[model samples]
Target: MKIEVRDVVKSYKHKTVLKNITFTMEGPKIIGFLGHNGAGKTTFLNLLAGLIATTDGTILVNGDNVFNTPSTLRDICFIAESGNFQEEMTIAQALKANSFFYPKWDEQLAQRLLQVFALNPKEKVRSLSKGMVSALGIITGFASNAAITIFDEPYIGLDVAARSMFYDLLIDQQIDNPRLYILSTHLIDEASELFEEIFILQEGQLLLQKTTDEWHKHIVAVKGNATDVAAAIVDLEIIDQHMFMQEMTAIVHTGGHPIEGYNVTLESVSLQDMLVYLSKQKARSGK
Candidate 1:
């Protein structure tokens, strides 16, 4: 599957959520769609799922307009946080009902995952806790076998162990049946390794698209004397800086090259931290 967003804009009244955002992604890979709160991650995903209309521009999933396009819609399964399954329906009933929407539904996988996730098929959806609901959503997403599967912070009430299980499932599913899996998440440090490619948004604008490695490659932290930190990053892009007595710490973009020495210590920044700094950067001084 191929998804293309060309100059997309989404607005509500006078406020714009996504501003002329544009990007493309292909299938058979795990994609990380990342941003901070109010970065329009959810809004963008809603547009991709055809749940809402774009105020301007277009979004195409496999060369077909996703909005009102049943063909495209059937191939894309979006599982968001909370309220996924009907409150009145039993686990089995809900699966039986939703499976009909996907032509490539994997019944055996669905049944087996019920056991893997420790969910009883006969259990009522309303009785299950938040974590259980998230597990059901995860199961449905995988078993749908859709060309594009989206998980928008679906692990809301899940614990560390459960989230790790979901991460393992992502790798397992990719190996067995290669397809597109777009994951929008805030647990960047934990799931950073799962991303083959990533798109980041900041303050209603698209930030950058890069491989996970590329996202972390040039970002470094230099700490030492203020003069040494300044000298070390004089030629590099300084993302942010902090002063502490005589010494200082600065996050720098090293232009993809290793910095040898300048009386400072160079340390690798976490993927989540790097992204935070990246988002703080503006395209044109915040206009």
Candidate 2:
């Protein structure tokens, strides 16, 4: 499956949330959507899943437009941070309902996930704990087997052990099913490994979109004597920097050589760290 968003724009009450955003993704892989709060990631994901319509753009899933078309959206599943299960229904009943909606639903996987999450199928949606509710959402999203599956912080209220369980299950199921997974989460480091590609939204703008491998390769962190390191990076734009009494640590968009006298330590940068630096840079530039 492939997702295509072209010239996408969304606004509420004259305020734009997504501005002229354009990107394309070929499926059967996992993607991590990273951004700060109110970065329009939810809105963007909603648009792709057809929960909301774009103000001016086209969202195509597997070559078919998702808006105003039920057939096209049937292959896509979008689960929010809060799973919108029927309050009066039991977990088993809700699972059955979801099975009817998605053509490729896997009952075995759902049942297995229920045991994995320690959720009782007979429990009513309203009676389940917050962690249970998140567990149910994760199970459904993964077992639905939709070509384009999107999860918005699917493990919101789980404990550390539970969250790790969810991550392990997601990885295993992905290897077997291999559908498109779009995950939005604040737990960036925990989920970064599952991401083959990355999309970053900042204040309603699509700031960056690249593969995880490529993003890591393009970024570098250096640490050495403050003055010498500063001189070495004088010509380059510093995304982020930390300074102490004598030495300083800085991250930059690597371009030229290192300073001769300074002892520089060039190290790999994580996607989360890169985004932090990028966001800080954007903030400083605005001021």
Candidate 3:
């Protein structure tokens, strides 16, 4: 699967959600779509699914305009935080409806997932709890098997055990039939292991796009006496930093070079921490 977003701009009245954003997603890979609230992650995903149009530029899926091409829309499946299925439909009915929308829909997988999620196919959507509703969305998304599957904060009401089950199912699906999966959530630590590449959107612009491995390699975290820390980061690109009376901690982009002689203690930065600092850096720079 190939999705090209060229100079894409999305606006609402006087405010813009995305500005001159351009990126290409070539799959089968699990990708993390991350940003703080209102950073335009949802708008970008909507563009991919052709649920909304851009103010300017284009989003192309396999060389076809995503907004106007019916075939391209069929290749993408999107499950939102809540209310994806008709409230009046039974679980079985919703699955049957989805089978018509997604040409690649797998009834066998859908049935299997019902067992996996402990959902009764006969249960009515309106009578189900919020967690059950989310389970339904998960079932449909996985069963759709669309070329590009997107989940936008899709586990809102799911319990820890249920969310873990979803993650395992997702990993299993990738192992058996790898495809493009774009997920956006605040549960970074829980989902970090599944991401191959990540796109960070900050204030409606593309902040960074790099593999999970590359992020760790290039963004270094260190702590030491203030003087030593300053020396260590003098020539490096500082992402974020904090200072106490006699000590300091800082994150920097090392350009993948080893900080051989610095008297600082090297630390591991979590994915969520990395994103937080990266966005802060972007905001400070007014970019």
Colliding pairs, model 2: none
> Candidate 1 lDDT, tens digit per residue, 1-287?
89999999999997998999888999789999988777899898888988899999999987889996888999988998666789999999999987999999999999988998999999999999888999999999999999999999978788999999999988999999999999998899899889999887878887667776876777778999987777778778777787878779899767788777578887878769866676566433462
RMSD (Å) per prediction = 3.0, 2.7, 2.2
Model 3 residue pairs with clashes: none
Overlapping backbone residue pairs in candidate 3 total 0
**Per-residue lDDT tens digits of candidate 3, residues 146-204?**
99999999888899999999999999999988899999998999999999998988889
Model 1 lowest lDDT segment of ten? 278-287
Error of 1 at 271 (Å): 2.0
What are the TM-scores, per candidate, against the unseen true structure?
0.89, 0.89, 0.92
Summarize candidate 2's per-residue lDDT along 177-273 as a digit string, tens digits. 8888889998999889888998888778876677876676556777888866777677765768988777798887654444455557777888778
* Worst lDDT 10-window in candidate 2: 254-263
Error at 236, model 2, angstroms: 5.1
TM-score of 2: 0.89
Point out the higher-scoring one by lDDT: 1 or 3: 3
Error of 2 at 147 (Å): 0.8
